[model samples]
Every structure is written in structure tokens, then in C-alpha cells.
Target chain A: MKPSSPLGARFRTAVLTLSLAVVATLGSVSRADVPVREEPQRPSAFGATEDAPLPTVAPGDLQGLLRNCDAERERAVAAQKLCEQDKTGVDFLGAAYAALWIILMAFFALVAIRQRRLSAELATLRERLARLGER
Target chain B: MSASSPDADLQPARPGVTWMPYVVAAALLVALFLVFFVAPRERTMGEVQRIFYFHVASAFAALIGWVGCAVASLAYLFLSARQGMEVIAKITDRLAHALGEIGVLFGTIVLITGPLWAKPVWKTYWTWEPRLVLMMLTQFLFIGYLVLRAYAKKDVAGRKLAAGIAVIGGPAVYLIHVAVELWGGNHPQVVSGQGGGLQHPDMQLTFAVAIASVLLFAASLVHLRMRHHAFTDELEDAYLELSDREDARS
Candidate 1:
């Protein structure tokens, strides 16, 4: 059987490349169709009138506020210690991702090794057949 | 034909390009970077939500492989039934087997990652959720097909039986997809329904890239596996011919 002319081969390659480009463009366009939904803003922690000017504090009131701050800091420290005791140090996210990549890489390595072994076996088989033929 | 038959060497085995594997490897590496670095972290789930990228992408790839296996199995069965194991039928058989194996590999990844993601979010390693159950069933069904292919005798009858199993197993994928809708479950509908799908554009972009990369990787695996299968078939044929010549000499 005769092979195709060089002109025909070039034309086929051109058509194949064009088709691939068109398909890629269409895929990207289709994926981009899903619009991202924007989230609504929540009110500030200071309340709705967060921009209002602060009222002047009495000297006596300031002293009380400082005492409250000291007590709150001591309580917060105790709460943090309790929380830390319950918290597990293991990072599940990192572990999950690591497990996934390990599985994939192992499979890839297995295939590569299998291919190499098969090629080597094939070479050995060919040599044995050649020796048999010589006899 | 005998071992010394000229036609054995006359058949051309097309040489595969050297660069295709490198291209796939690079694409997958880029996808990994995009998944970890580029995609926006979910507000509620935080860092653990990153698992969703590859988990969903692998599910997509596995589904594609199973569906491809079903189609190829049908083609092989139809062609072999009519034409008695012709080249096209044999090629389809090889494709079906390769796709089934690749699908199982990806499916195993899905099952493993599901539990890893679930343990932190759901406070348990496993659940009897509808989608989970259905996905498990689907994985088991195809796995049964693989077991049959591996353990069964190397003959047309074995191939036919395995092909039939693949045909029956293909619809399990559809059932798994609809299982969540059919029964109320704990599984999050991130890709469908109202309210809480992907909110960030970067998440969407990363998901797309991940899916494309996984699909490209799957295609490369199937191609390489098919080539391996073809070479094995050729080697087996050559061995049989040589054995026949030895017997004739004896």
C-alpha cells in the first residue's frame, strides 16, 4: 500500500491542530459560564452605628474598664489552655492531600517499572528466538 | 503462521512519541500548584476543603473511564459476536480492560479521600449516607469486574463474561449520581442545587484546571496501558509460534 502524499499529510496535520484549538476554546468558554456568587457584607462588631464618634469617658469609669480588662485576660488564658488540651495536633488536610499524591505516584511508578520489565523480557525472548533460528 | 513467517515482522508497530508523557506530567504539576496555592480556601471548612478539588476531579475521571469501558465492552462484544475476534474487536477488548483498571484506581482514590475529608467534617470516619453507599456499591461492582478479568481463564469465554459484568456495572455510576437526590443525605451538594456551591471564582477556575489535568492524565494512562496490552499480545503470539516450531522439530 502507498503512503499519502506530503501535501495530504500536511493538510491533515493542519486540520487536526485547528480542531484541537477550537475544542480547547469551547471548553474554556463553557467552564467560564458559571458566574461567581457574591456574598453579602455583615454589620460591624461595634453595632450598626459603627462610624459614630466615641463619647468621652469619666476617669473613674476608665479605672473600672482597666480592671475588667485584666480579669477578662486571666479568664481568656484559662479558656485557651482548656481548648488547647482538646485540640489534636494532626493536620488532616495535609494528610489527606499527601495520601492522594502518594497513591497516584505509586501507581505511576508501578506502570513505569512494569513497562521496563516487559521491554527487557521482550529483548531476552527475541535473543532466545534468534539462537533457536541459528540452530 | 510459523515462527519464521515473514508476515510476523511485516506488521508495523507505530512508535509512540517521547514527549507526550512529559507534557502530561507538567500539566499535572501545574494542576497540583493551582489546587494548593491558587484556589481560594472555603470560609467554613478552611484548609480541609482543598481535598474537594482532587476528590471531585478523580471522581469525574473514574466515571469517564467506567463509561468508556462500557462502550468499548459493548463494541467488543458486538464485533466479536459477528466477526469472530477480528483486530477491531481485539482492540476494543484491550481498551475495555485498560479503562476498567484505570477507573478502579481512581475510584480507590475517591473512597480513601472521602473518609479523610469526612472524619474532620462529619466527626466520623465513615457513614451510611446514600451517596456514599451508592458510590461504594459502584466501586465494588467494577472491582468485581476487575477480579473476574484477573482470575478468569485467558480465553474468549472469560473475556465475554467480564465484558458482560462491565456492561451491567456501567449503570451504577448513574445511580451513584442520583442517589443524593433520591434520598436525603449528609453529603454536600457543592456542584449542584441552590445556596452553597462554590462562591469564589478562583475555586471555580482551580476546579476546572484540576478536572482537565486529571482527564489528560487518565487518557495518557489508558494509552500507555493499551500499548502494553498490545505488546503483551504480540509477545504471546511470538512465543506460541516458537513453541509450535520446537514441537514440529521434535
Candidate 2:
């Protein structure tokens, strides 16, 4: 597609950004299963789930496999929890922002009203003085 | 005909005959409509996610004001063209204040709606994560900038002092990202550290468009704000001159 329109460029950028992100996430998981243990490690506790989907690596010792599954599950839960907390903080900040706008607009309107009133009053006084000068 | 001193009232806006305020008000309304109804709701967050439009847009405006402040300050520092730079500084300062106010407002919205959007998925509110922390710090620094400008009187010494702070404050504001990167939290920090992108094609496009629209609105708003500052300054000077005459009569 031509890169002329904003829509096209945005779409292109979005596609690139998304693909990169997916690769990054997948890459982390694939690379993280390092051989930290001297002996060959097995799947995690989550390995108990026969239906569980994981790398197609040949099954290893049952205990190690189970431990690996458990660790993966724990990581997933932790990540989700982190997202939740972040959301809350974002919410708090949002309300604070709205309140500020409300107060600011109200103050602005009030001042405008007050100034208009004073200006009108001053105008009226000037008119009175002009009439006295005519007399 | 407002003769109010620059720092006299820490007030919002006084009564004035001007089209810009209405323009701003109209632009704001248009922005609201376009953002909420026109722009498609997020695929990920759905309807509640609509708040992201104004929330992020306001933040973008603040960013514009920040950049403007830095530029105007620099012009003042380098050129020393008193009238032009001083005028620009005043206008940019006002823009900064206006945007800062809006930023605080939207920043808070991002926080509240953030959980509403997140709770469905994460089932929680509040986090110590880096993104959120950095966002909060950004809000705090703007608030400080506004308060500092207000407290600083309008004078040679005051302008120089404010200019000094602005030089330090401008770049310093972004350091919130650095601070956030230092700690643990689930904020995507790619540019700063964490993979900040969710990596969904649709999400990315929508986000970019949303941000662009908001930037346009801010650019227009700041332009009007700068003009308002110049006229308002002229009006105040006229009033001061009149006030001096009254003093002589008394």
C-alpha cells in the first residue's frame, strides 16, 4: 500500500509494532528455560495437566516438569496482578484530573461573571457622572 | 480591560470581550465529540475504554505546552529580544499553565478509567509499576511548574529566576521515566524498558490516530492562548495607565 495516507502509515506502523511485541514475548519464554540446574530439568507443576500446551521439548523427569509448569503459572498470575495494580493507580489519577477541570472551569466562569458585573457597574457610574456634568 | 497583575489573583479567567475563549470552548467541544463518538472504541478495552481519548489527548496537550515552554525560554535566553521573547514567554507560560491544568484533569481520568479498563482483565486497582509511577511524576512536575510560576512575581529578577528553573525543569520532567525504569512494576518500559506496547495492530493504529488528533487540538489551543496573552497584556497596561491618573487626582 502507498504510504501517502495517514491511515496506511498508521496501519503499517501498528502491524510492525504488534508483530515485534509478539516476537519479544515469545522470545522471552523460549530463551528463559536456561539450564540453570546442572542436571537436566523437567516440566513445571503445571505439567500435571495433560492438556497443557508448552514447548515440544521431549518430556523430562516428572518432578522437574511439574516444577517448571508451576513456575510458569505463577509468573502468569504475577503479571496479571501487576496489571491490575497499575490500572487502579491510573483510575485514581483520572478522577483527580476530572475534578481539577470542573474546579477550573467553574472558577473561570465565576471570574468572568464577576468582572462583567463590575464593568457594567462602572459603566453605570460613568453615565451618572456624565449627566451631572451636562447639568 | 483587565488590569489584574500577572500574579494578582491566581484566578482562572476574568471577563473579557474576545473570540478566542469561545474558540477554545468550541474546539474543546468538538474534540469531545470527535473523540467519544467519532473515534472507534478500542478493540481491547471496549466502551469503557473510550475515556482514553480525552485522557491521553490532554496529556499530549501538556506535552505540547512543555515543549513550547522550553523553546520560548531558550529564545528568551539566546536572543534577548526583550519584547518578542518576553511576549512569547508570557504566552507560553499561560499555555503551560492551561495545559498543566488540563493534564492534571486528564491524568486523573487515565488513572480512574485505567482500573475500570484493567479490572475486567486484571481485577485490581492501583499498582507500583513504572508506567503509572512515571505518569504520576509527570503530573506532579507540571503542578510544581504552575505553582512556581504563580509564586514567582513578574519582574526582571522573577523572569530570570523562572527562566533558570524552566531550563532545569524542562528536561528534568522527563526523568520520571528513568526513575520508573529503576523499579519494578508492570509498565511496559521499552522506550524507557518494559515492553510498553501490547503489539496489537489495531490497537497501535488507534492509539497513534488518537494521539495525533489530540495534538492538533492542543496546537490550535496554544495558538489562541498565545494571542490572548498579548492582548491581555496590552489591556492590563492600559488599565495601569488609567489607574495612575486616578492616583494623581486623589
Q: Which one wins on lDDT?
A: 1
Give one digit per residue, the lDDT tens place, for model 1 in B111-179: 898888776666666666677877776777677666666544246776787899899877888877877
Cα displacement (Å) at residue B44, model 2: 7.1
Docking class of 1: incorrect
Fraction of native contacts under 8 Å reproduced by each candidate: 0.17, 0.00
Candidate 2's residue-wise lDDT over B195-237, tens digit each? 3442434444445565665565455545544444444444445
Lowest summed lDDT over 10 consecutive residues: which window, candidate 1 chain B?
B6-15
lDDT of each: 0.72, 0.49
Q: C-alpha displacement of B52 in model 2, angstroms?
A: 4.0
Instruction: State the displacement of the C-alpha of residue B38, model 2, in Å, after optimal TM-score superposition.
Output: 8.6
How far residue A119's Cα lies from its native spot in candidate 1, in Å, is: 2.8
lDDT score, candidate 2, position A52: 39
Query: On residues A1-135, what C-alpha lDDT tens digit does candidate 2 reach at each position?
Result: 844644334435544654576578558757764333222111111111112355444566777778778878876775566455446544543554465467556745754675565455445544543544465
Q: Tell me each candidate's i-RMS in Å.
A: 14.4, 16.7
lDDT of 1 at B107: 91
The Cα error of candidate 2 at residue B204, in Å, is 4.3
